[model samples]
Target chain A: MSPSVAYGTDIDERTKAAEQSATDVLTAPDIPWNLVIWNDPVNLMSYVSFVFQSYFGYSESKAHKLMMEVHKKGRSIVAHGSKEQVEQHAVAMHGYGLWATVEKAASGNETPGKGGRQRG
Target chain B: MAKAFKYGLKGISGYLEPAERDLLRGLLDDVISMLESDVRENEDPLAALIGLDMDVKQPGDRALLRLLPNVMKDDDGGSLEFRQLTERSVRESKIGALRAAALGLDKNELVLTPDDATRWSMALNDVRLVLAERLDIRDEADAEHIHSMQDWSQAEDVESYLALVYNFTTWLQESLVQAMMAARQAKS
Candidate 1:
């Protein structure tokens, strides 16, 4: 399913630079944590994508990419933030019945999108 | 047979036969009961009221553990601390959704507002998850095996019955999510 055009926006260089600096600062002392969604046999692919789109406000392509990563790679770091932020997301993901866990970003080799802070 | 949920002028709507409604109601209630915590004797009333459950342990049952997974993958102490702070509220919200969906099943014709549809989807998903666990659906291969059990005549055993149920919920949730996506598109 295609997401609305309004939902998808290009990340410009200015935004990218700001996010890079923010990530650098956040990583220095408080290592950002990742909210990883693990793939399971039960959760519907559409439902997982919908949660990504609705809960995290990821665009359809972005959500589908993350969902496919989870399905193929066995897990995908869907979001990353402070420990508490990722923990809150973990709870919300559990509420949606998706298998989820939080980990310090350094603990895993894969880094999710740079400064992927969720919209409130 | 239940109609696949669809988004229309009246929002997301679906229809189910009485037996189907009863079946769904049973599933929703089962998940609700699984999530509901038992009252402890001489417990701290304030902590309970504030949704703290320091006594909460990692669920022993596989299905229950699936429902309320530990936050940290390797840090049990940290996970337990986070669980103490958040698990109670999570359980309450899950039970609330399960109960809401169960209450909606009282009628055969289901019309759902966005909120109702969200709760229904969550409830159906939770049902499917627990059923998957019981059916021992560990991987895609196991899921495919379960998905192949479509004929009612083949549901001669408990495992097959659960597989059928899991497939039913999976279909239902897929349709509901599609409708939700459509509704979201319409709004945007």
Candidate 2:
């Protein structure tokens, strides 16, 4: 297999930076965007979790947690980064046949790891 | 009958009958054709080389749109801009995987390398996505209705046949993913 991108490995650090930036008044360019995975009937649950684990380099349990959130809540903000970063992830998700979209973090109701901070 | 894919000492492997292999090849080909772009005489060579498609519009076909979805949630302009810059490459990569997987269907004894397994998983997922759209699987309940049509003897019409095919691919993909997870665990 090709070397998986370690995007999820540094997510906690980025999330902390995002939270710190959120506290200060920020400009438009400084605002973070989210990569949201939406639930669809066609994608198998196992396949969806696999994509999260392989593509994002997320732990199996963390990937399953996000997959369940998508299944139950209809969508989940699986990652947050600069617009360019999240958009790149969105394209990768589409390539894997997962229904994904990008949105401004403030516009969405959830943030990455908002459900629980404990790592699985 | 086909065996579910499994991970073992020699990587991932599965078995499919000749008829089942032909069915999957046809499905993969269909998705590839849907993703292939039409060449225009007036298109700029440089832009095409760089994978730019300024004239690319949002796919009107529901199935096509599902495969190549809008990137942004609410901004059409933003989504279009992003699509113009990246949609061509996305379509090309998807077509590449579909074609590779189709080529691998030539034999009944399928042994896949890690890269091949990833491509096969992607190819199977795309096939299922298109089949689901045709079957009008709008929600979990609709998927359940389709999934319930597993008896091949009951395929009396096009829809029933499609439902069966969809279910078959779903089962195949689910097993492939499970095997992939097992492989990942072994490596790490």
Candidate 3:
């Protein structure tokens, strides 16, 4: 008596892979939102950074970088995450007295380049 | 006692400048009284709202941080402008000092916040350092630092100023949280 081993199917690896990929995409958070802070006549920049750092637990350097983005670019995306995550951050920022909001993130906007502006 | 976020713990105590000390004492008392009254008169939503708005306390880095601007305006139209500047230019010491003086405060009167001089000075210094580092104004002439906003002052203007800033901030803060929540909801 001979026992034969049978491999069920090698016919649809590609299809299975595609299905997995689709499911991953579906489960992922869609519509990236930016947590923006507008420039105001009140609310000091340092205070803004302090808020960012204290509320979000951002490092001093990270907080300052975000603050400058708000100061120079007129608004900033301090955090990027699922909608609920960003909303929580916005509320925290508000609590700290910084004007903050979340909006649809622009496409292809990569993270800060060159790090600091290297200003004199 | 151990605290998670110890924002306002001054090392030196009770060294506030005369003007600043008086302002702190006055604001502290008024806010406290209003809050207490609001608790009793919770029936009035507006009053309660105002009290909640005024109850904000940042208490970070040793500076007695209070949220919700409360400026009082008078027939003469003074002080609101000064308080407005103080809120905006929170990081500048020299400018804040000058601004305080400009708004009818004598130099000596603005010397030290009587609440706790060492702590107050340290907090002020910390604010100054942070501002200097973060403030990359294209040139030295960029807006005369932070306190330039206060060119004048009035005694009663604090409440009105606070009211305006509070309303705007509240709206924005609410909107921001809502929008973010909506996005989150959509995501989930």
- Measured by DockQ, the strongest candidate is 1
Compute the lDDT of residue B118 as modeled in candidate 3.
21
User: What is the fnat score of candidate 3?
Assistant: 0.02
lDDT of 3 at B155: 20
Compose the digit string of candidate 3's lDDT tens values, residues B1-188: 11111112231111235644344334333333332332233244663443233332323422223232222212112223323333323323323332332333233222322222222222333233223223332333442443333323422475434333233222322332333223323333
User: Weakest 10 consecutive residues, lDDT, candidate 2 chain A?
Assistant: A111-120
Model 2 residue runs over 4 Å out of place are A1-31, A114-120, B37-41
Q: Give DockQ per model, in order.
A: 0.66, 0.63, 0.05
**Considering every candidate listed, which one attains the maximal TM-score?**
1
Please list, in the order the candidates appear, how each scores on TM-score for chain B only.
Answer: 0.97, 0.98, 0.22
Clashes of 1: 0
Candidate 2 lDDT score relative to the true structure: 0.88
Give candidates' CA RMSD values in order: 3.7, 5.2, 18.3
For each candidate, give its TM-score against the true structure: 0.90, 0.88, 0.39
| Over 4 Å off, model 1 | A1-29, A114-120
Candidate closer to the true structure by lDDT (higher is better), 1 or 2: 2
lDDT over C-alpha atoms for residue A81 of model 3: 59
lDDT of each: 0.86, 0.88, 0.40
Residue B57 shift from truth in candidate 3, angstroms: 23
CA-based DockQ, model 3:
0.05
Chain B of candidate 1 vs. true chain B, TM = 0.97
